[model samples]
Target: MLWLYLHFPHLLLDHIRRTREETGALVIVEGSGQKVIQACPEARDQGVHGGMRLKTAISLVPELGTVRADQQQEARILEDQARWLYRYAAHIVLVPPDGLMAEIGSLQRLYGGLPAAWQTVEQALDERQLIAWPGLGHTPLAARLIARAGKGECTDDKGHIQRTLGQMPLLAAEFDARTCTRLQRLGLNTLGEVFALPAAELARRLSPETLARVQKIQGTRPDPQAPWQPPHHFRQQADFVQEIEQSQGLLFPLQRILAELEEDLCWRQQETDSLLLVLQHRHEEPSRLRIRTSGPEHRAEAFLNLVRLRFEQHPLRAPVMSLQLSVKRFLGREADTGQDLLGESQDLNEAWHTLMSRLQARLGDQALQQLSPQADHRPERAWTASGVQRNNRPAATMNDQLPRRPLWLLQGPQPLTEAPTAWFAGPERISGGWWDGQRVHRDYYIAQLHNGQLAWVFRDVRDGWFVHGWFG
Candidate 1:
């Protein structure tokens, strides 16, 4: 079986740096915060290197940004990278903290060759701004060792792989310090020298566990790796080293995560109408915000715009420590209705939804409403204001069969001072409201006022005349 392994030297550092616009020196310190485990180019440009003491690094670059190294964070980011790689290769085995092993032998024909498949993964990492070293081998362990050493290549030749593997020193073979020292003292410096010894002699010289590791790397023993499958839903979070005091600061981090969501949605050929964003605070309860769109949407720019609006409407109550974005429910993507099948023109509904989503984000959802018809026949009582309901099909109508009504309806009845000169329509009766105790009993008419204005007048049972509305 052919295997491909990708090694990320500074996965966490790359992830954190991409979240902001600043180019200041940044370093990932050891868990204990005493030493630097990873440093960015800017930090290295200022003489800050990995394995340097944290105090020295800070001294070199006084404005250096420091993030404490974390195993869980690195593992999570590694899985995220695997999720993206899964699009190209199906059989993926995640190597925790910063590596991925993909069995690409089966894809030899799918991508034209193993080198082409390797190139696809390389391009994907480049597009994501991640630093990766790729290695190819017949065994998982061999690929991992070569990748870590930055000596990886695309050749599948057994001789080439063996010659490369033969040159790896005992230290790079993943042996314990004692074993490497013992081998070095015995003048066995490289794996090739160690392999030159007889099987029985090598087994007697090395421990059983070390012997097993060597056999696995040589492909004489099985190295079973469970394949990773992606989740049905999408979720990602960004933890910050520094607490963000302003609500706007959260946008930079959210931008990267939302972009991931967009990519995932596009890959699935589905869209989401809602997203849940939870902002963690140091001392206050976590603030949860649900961002909704007028319709199913997969574009990152649209999601970011809506989130920006939500931030403007709701300010941060406390300093944010982390940001979590999740989407559990996804809707099937609808066909672009406003476009031709040939794909020359674009969809109009897409533009409409963009506008509605932005407007609803700026104003509260409840602030925007739609007018719907009520059961009452009274002009004022015949319609009601309700929340806007967006859908593809037309709205079901209940008042379409009702008598002709003016486009403009008056709010209250005004007393008429003079009688009408002529009448065009009828005394359309609308006299029922006793159910809710607001009873109405009046005779309505359409007439022209003495001032030459078309009006809707009504006289109550008590003989009081009032102009209820005007026809425009």
Candidate 2:
């Protein structure tokens, strides 16, 4: 089974910026630095293109709308789109900020074949007001290339993969800029020309190696892709009456989101063990917040409890526009009487969700937070405050018996004036990983200091005494 790879090479950052700034205006964004990111179709019609210098492109179409490409922002929106599309296909491969590939082989059968599946996907995207060109083929590469060449629909051909692909320009092969130029100069502008060349001869002609790539795209060699998998059976979402800012605003919104999720859990006949919430903000990347249950839960109230506690301590830093919740792990659903209550229980969930909504209306995403585990063994390294739905694990947990640790560690250890330890544990000397050049070598000690602060101190073989962490 091949795949449906959709390419949006021209859906550049300029289009987004312009679409926001001037509706119906043709825009082509060129990154200020070295790389070209996007050129609008209108700009392309004027002979502008991706990778063309911004100034040169403007010279081609003096009136062309231009903006510096925000690669980060474009990528964020693309990811959010990918996240939403997970509901359609379990396996989705994002082709970065502009495109995606979905394993539609299995989906085709479910949707009653290729065309039907394509239509279903198109319809879903339409609801979101996003347009994508779909290309169906036996391989991910083939599908992607054909789609970029603007093949809107795949003709039925169980065996005509090469023939269908023969029509596309060679640039669709994802060749390097120089290779593409070389192909054009040689009048081998089409895939058919490239395909006609004997593999051995073609390999010998290319620089930096082309034999392997040629073989992969030609289907003579297999190119494997690791498909993206959506988490099993859990999601939470909240629709804001208005966009929100501040960590305080999330409390109420999350309340309703949890309530809706509680119902979804019931319908799925599953109990959530661990769930994640993805928060999307206007013009910024979405953040992820995840919670793990000590045990499986179907109770809406209990689920909300954890989210509430997390929000109380941390709030949003920026205003959020939308919220998405997903369950990464879950257990079998078991009916609970509390959630089954007629109206009052549901009301509480609604109230809490409402409160969160109001808080977000004013506080923004940066004001809200949830503590996530850290990987480091240090106490202060235990957790970090992250956006509600941000996915960052806690610091590494090393052997607890390594040494005495501190509960409260300074953000950056403060310099101590005088030595205050009554009893000292032997210094464990360790250092040297300066390849990237942020080097540290210290003799660490467990000391009961003067002010009754049991602290972790280290003396660099050179820098004398420096406090590292504290055991509150």
Candidate 3:
């Protein structure tokens, strides 16, 4: 099996740097806060390096930023990276503290070739602003060793992998100090020399575990790895080295997260109707913004636009230290919306959704209302207000087959003082509301008034003629 190993030498520092807008000297200090364990390029330029005392690093760059290393946090970040790599390869093995390994043998045909697969992962790392060393080998152990030793290269040839592994220094093989000391006494300086020894004699000299490690690296033994599986729901977060005081500042990181979400949805062949955005603060409670679409949506732009509108409406309550976007509600795949024969989307539904989403965002959700037909026979109570939706009931379906009602209905019926100039279609009898307190018995007609306005006039059996409404 062909395995690809990615070594992150500065995962902790990279994790912290990605959230910052400015480039500065930065380093990750050990938990003791005495020695620097990892340093960025800017810090190296300022003469800071790993293993240097924190005070010494600060002496070089007085403005250096430092973050204490945490094993738990680093593992979580590593899993986050694994989550991203799982999109490309199915079989992934997490190497704690700094690395990830994936079996690409099964993906050769799917991604075209080894070069393409390597490029895909490399591109993702670049986009994520991460620093990694990638190595390829016939075994996971070999690939990981090559990557950690900084001898990584993209090649699947067994001969090349063997040669690269052979040249690795004894120390870079990750053997214990005692083993290295024993090998050094035997004048074995490189892996090539040690590997040249007879297997039986080598096994007799080395510990069982060390011998097994060597055999696994040389592909002489099987090294099975448990594959990593993504969680059922999607939740991605971004941390900021600098706190974001304004809502607009949060959008940059949010844009990247949303794009990742779009990719996740597309990969799953599904859509979602709702998203929950949580903004973590330094001292105050986190602010939660729930974004709901009119229909199942998968496009990143649509989500981003709605989020932007939401931010415009609600200002930030506190400075945000981190932001997380999650979608728990998974919806079925939407049908092909309005694609034409030419493959271009007619976008009727898309446009309608956009309009409704924007209006709901600008106006409160309750501000927009839809008119839905009710069972009432009274002209004024014939329709009720409903929430706006992507698919609205056709207006023609309301009161179908019934006598036409004027499009514009007056608040109350007015007494008709003057006679009608002409009478149009009319004489529709209406009687209802006995179940309630008020009962109505009338003969409604469409008549043209003296001012050329077509009015809805009704003669109440108990009262007199009254103008009820007007037709557009």
Ranking, TM-score, top scorer first: 1, 3, 2
lDDT of 1 by residue, 153-228 (tens): 8899999999999999888998988888888998988998877777667778777766777888889889999999
Indicate the worst ten consecutive residues by lDDT in candidate 2. Answer: 14-23
Cα lDDT over the full model 3: 0.87
Query: Relative to the unseen true structure, what is the C-alpha lDDT of residue 364 in candidate 1, on a scale of 0 to 100?
Result: 70
Give the clashing pairs for model 3.
Answer: none
The TM-scores of all predictions, comma-separated, are 0.79, 0.49, 0.77
lDDT of 3 by residue, 268-380 (tens): 88999889999999899899888988778899999999999999999999888889899999988866757744455648777877888888877878998988667788887
Model 2: residues >4 Å from true position, as ranges?
A: 9-28, 33-68, 156-160, 181-187, 205-208, 230-472
lDDT against the true structure, per candidate, is: 0.87, 0.65, 0.87
Total backbone clashes of candidate 1, pairs 3 or more residues apart or in separate chains = 0
How far residue 324's Cα lies from its native spot in candidate 1, in Å, is 3.1
| Residue 249 alpha-carbon offset, candidate 1, angstroms | 3.7
lDDT computed for candidate 1: 0.87
The order by descending lDDT is 3, 1, 2
C-alpha positional error of residue 255 in candidate 3 after TM-score superposition, expressed in Å: 2.3
The segments of candidate 3 whose C-alpha lies over 4 angstroms from its true place after superposition are 110-112, 185-187, 197-205, 332-345, 374-386, 392-472
